[model samples]
Target: MAFVNPEREEIKGLLEGNTTIAVVGLSDNPERTSHSVSQAMQQRGYRIIPVNPAAAGDILGEKSYPDLGSVPEPIGIVNVFRRSEFTPAIAREAVAIGAKILWLQLGVYSEEAAAIAQEGGLTVIMDRCIKVEDSILRPDIRRI
Candidate 1:
């Protein structure tokens, strides 16, 4: 069977309830989409946790973790910026860390990853941009 993302109300609920997001493959470079998206989310009051081996110390004013396992606090969402092929492994890790949501950025989708995350009891969203969703679903949130 094919995978389908949650409905608009469900996605809105996830965004409304979750505050902390772990951005996998987040890059420190301002030119990267991950950086910009995360920054936007942060401006809207979501805590962005940067997870990238290549980037340590701080990216976007938050400490960078090597992987999802190393994040000390509980993560609300695992927002993946990696390619489709890389998402399944990230799904597994997000499950292990008890993340409530698995969000694949626009243009990034994998049926295998969605299945894994859904089976692990996560709210899965694919081929969508969180920043765009937030702006659309929650118009009260100001865009920076």
Candidate 2:
């Protein structure tokens, strides 16, 4: 069977309920899409945890971790900026860390990763941008 993303209502609920988001493959470069998107989410009041081995340091004023396993707090969402090929392992790690949502950013999608996350009891959103979704679903946040 083919995979389908959650409905808009469900997605809105996930965004409304979740707080801290672990952004996998986040880069320190402000020019990077991950950095911009994470910054937007942060402006909307979501805590962004940067996860990148090469750039494991302060990023956008938040502490960075080498990987999801190293994040010391409970992660509400695992927002991925990595390639599709890399997502399954990230999904598995997100599951291990007890993340509620597995969000693949715009232009990134992997059926294998979605399956892993779904089987692990996580809500999955693929080929979508969390920043964009929040702007659309929660207009009140956009005003801020």
Candidate 3:
């Protein structure tokens, strides 16, 4: 199979198409990158489901899940904010949970994880910030 290259257009399309985003490693602290990114996505009318083991309760007015398996509904996107070494596990869980997309945040990359997600037929994006993409590509979408 050809490589899954997430180009600018594909990233824009994913940002526009997916409405629910599960932010893995999202922190409760507003200062954290995950929180800021989730906030931005939430503002863009995307439901931000915080997925963090350390944070099990409510965050940003939404309940946090321990992992992808704990999320009750089908997630349109799994935006990971974890390290590259930890991405394979997240990718496995995301695939098992049937997430349509696997998004590794800026500064994170893992070829193995990308392969796993792609092998499962899930869209894979790495080393890019979703918030930046949304803001730059589709500014029409205002966050709530």
Candidate 4:
């Protein structure tokens, strides 16, 4: 069967329930989409964990981890900014680290990865921007 994401309402609840987002492939550069989006989420009261292997230091004032498994705290979501071709491995890592959600950023998706994440008990969201979704779901609320 083709992969299907959770309903809009369910997605909203997912956002409500999960406040910590581990961003895979997050960039240290403020000019990057990953950086801007993650920063926005952080401003919305969601904790952002940077998971870039090549990170020079922290991103957005939070210590950067090389991967999801390396993150010391529990992760609520794994938001991926990497290419579609790289998602399956990231999915496995998310699953391994017990993340509750695997979110593929806009224009990035992999059926194989989605299936892997779903089978591993993670809610899978593909080709969507988490910051946009959060803005749509909770427009009335902004932490900062």
Candidate 5:
């Protein structure tokens, strides 16, 4: 079966309820899309938790964890910036960490990943830019 993303209203409500995001494959470099997107989310009042194996110490101001399981606090959303092939493992980790949402960034998509997250009771959104969705759906949130 094919995978489908949540409706616009559902996504908007999920974003409104969750203020924290765990960004997997987040890069330390400011030029990377992950960094910029996360920065924008942070500016919009969402907490950005960097999850990367190679990132030096921190990306943005938050402490970086090598994987989702390493994160200490509860994760509201697991936003992945990795390639399509790598998302299944990320989804498993997100499920293990009991995250509510599994969001695959723009150009990233995996049916297997979506199935895994969905079976684990998470709302799965693939091949979309979280930043763009937030900007469009939550117009009340002002950028700082």
Candidate 6:
């Protein structure tokens, strides 16, 4: 399957329009990338929903869920922090839960997962860091 980087307009629209981000694999430890990124997004006015089975009870002052389906609110984006091999399951769940976008964090890639997301008509971004992209592309906006 072919992968595409969303245009500036699309990314801008997503950044401006969507506020809730489901961070799958989010960790409680502040040192972790997931925590930092999620925290950054939260500071940027986005509602960060941390999804981790181990931390199902809490995270970032919000109740964490076991998975995307467990999240009660509408998810604008599903930002995955798991390895590439773990993405298809998350992608399926994200699509099933009606997420508008599936974002695999930097160093993550999954052709199958991306294909599944794209097939379900959800916008997919792989091997990219949302924080860096937002910071570089939208410099005026501080990420935390």
Question: 105, model 4: CA deviation in Å?
Answer: 0.5
For model 1, the local distance difference test gives 0.96
TM-score attained by model 3: 0.94
Model 2 has a clash total of 0
lDDT winner between candidates 1 and 2: 1
Model 2 error, position 14 (Å): 0.3
Q: What is the C-alpha lDDT of each candidate?
A: 0.96, 0.93, 0.90, 0.94, 0.94, 0.88
Consecutive 10-residue window with the lowest summed lDDT within model 5: 53-62
Best by lDDT: 1
Pitting candidate 5 against candidate 6, the one with the higher lDDT is 5
Residues 1-144 of candidate 5 have per-residue lDDT tens digits of 788898999999999999999999989989999999999999999999999988868679899998899999999999999999999999999999899999999999999999999999999999999999999999999977
Worst 10 residues of 4 by lDDT: 135-144
lDDT of 2 at 107: 92
Candidate 5 Cα misplacement greater than 4 A, ranges: none
Writing each residue's lDDT as its tens digit, candidate 6 over 1-144 gives 377778867787777777889999999999999999888888877899999998857789889998888888999989999999999999999889999999999999998999999899899888989887776666777545
TM-score of each: 0.97, 0.97, 0.94, 0.98, 0.98, 0.93
Q: Which stretches of candidate 4 lie over 4 Å from their true place?
A: none
lDDT of 5: 0.94
What tens digits encode model 1's per-residue C-alpha lDDT throughout 76-134?
Answer: 99999999999999999999999999999999999999999999999899999999999
* lDDT at residue 8 of model 6 (Cα atoms): 67
- Give residue 55's lDDT in candidate 4 (0 to 100): 95
